[model samples]
Target: MKKHCMGRVVAASAVLVSSGAIAFVPASAASATEADCDGIGVIGVFKAVESGASFNYNGRRVELQNESALDRYSRAEIKSGRKAGDRLWVDRSFHAFPDFKGIVSDQSAKSDGWKMCGPYTGSRTQSVFNANYAARACAEIDGTTLCGKWYVD
Candidate 1:
């Protein structure tokens, strides 16, 4: 159910930025549709402006901006379709969604999708999927060339 959410997209996209620090977000019991991203646990995130809104599938929004983390990690967001329409996530492949590079978490991982995003993290207390893919982030932060270790699933 998409409203005239372009401005909302831009507004949301505008806030897409990650702080160069770690904040362990606990995983949720089930998948969620809220912007809070209850189920999907985001390991790490950075200024992946190069990804170019990987969350947007065929122009529809998939992930919601992480408001608390300055939109760093585009939290996996599920929107209720008309009577729950079919999701295009079936054909799991890198080029499945040419314009998008979705995180493809948990179930989505079973099927091919875009590379993951975050830091190489771990959790002994519970199950956490950590991808070793390195995502180098080199962005100008406060007039300084900020570059360091960022991860991609």
Candidate 2:
């Protein structure tokens, strides 16, 4: 009886394949951040205000840049947290795309810190940047965890 069941299953699969109803096609390979790019290059800019470092998602590391900007942002973020309508900007020109920006909204506190959700607008790419209390910008694209910056802000 087990052999008969296996034979029937094989016959059914053969029939489906022959009729083109079960054509097997290889799934196209995707990179970790492919969804983040969405066919357009995406560059994430985050500032570690407390540390005076700039974090880029593309590099996945921190670099020293404008200390004044980092300090100011750090103070503001640590003081009152991100306010509604606070803007986060990304220069699409830098990434070979167009300009895209998002605003802070829907703020909530988590165990680690505060989380803010906002969407990027005025671009072909549909993406959102979530800011955390640790001063990191996080976005998950294509099953990949992308983050930028880490500080008070």
Candidate 3:
């Protein structure tokens, strides 16, 4: 008597049957979708002008002008029985000026969407200077997260 294990491979997506039971393996599992953010409904939208950077949140707005540096903007959605949203923004500056400011917002409902913004500045001197800026957007729904980022130099 000879015993053999018979199997076949399909085009990535395949079904295996054994003992009157079947299981399926999908072709692609890692894909970017809206549910990447873990149900967090927060987004960050930022812009940079000649002087500084500006950010907005759910119709609420904050602007940093002249001699300021925007650091990071982040958002997260909380999964609860009712659902909620959270947002955070941070900035920094120097030279006898206190340029660090932090902003945060919370929403009562999970289905609600939120936004945030901030600025980014590089080093400078009397002779040579470097100016840079950036922006980002993020959102989450159904336990999925999505994000987009941009920069200027």
User: 41-130 in candidate 1: lDDT tens per residue?
Assistant: 445442222243223222333222222343333322223221233221101112232233334332222233223222111110111222
What's model 2's TM-score? 0.24
lDDT for every model? 0.24, 0.24, 0.23
Query: Using TM-score as the measure, which candidate wins?
Result: 2
Candidate 3 per-residue lDDT, tens place, 1-153, comes to 322112211123223333211123342122232332221322234223222123332332333322223333222111122123332222111111123222211111111222122111111101101132222222222232222222122
The candidate scoring highest on lDDT is: 1
Which portions of model 3 miss their true places by more than 4 Å? 1-131
User: TM-score of the candidate numbered 3?
Assistant: 0.19
Residues 1-153 of candidate 2: C-alpha lDDT, one tens digit per residue: 111111111111111123221212122111222233222332343233322223332223322211242222221111122233222221111111123222211111122223222222111222222222233333322333232333322
lDDT of 3: 0.23
Sorted on lDDT, best first, the list reads: 1, 2, 3
Backbone clash count, each prediction separately: 4, 1, 11
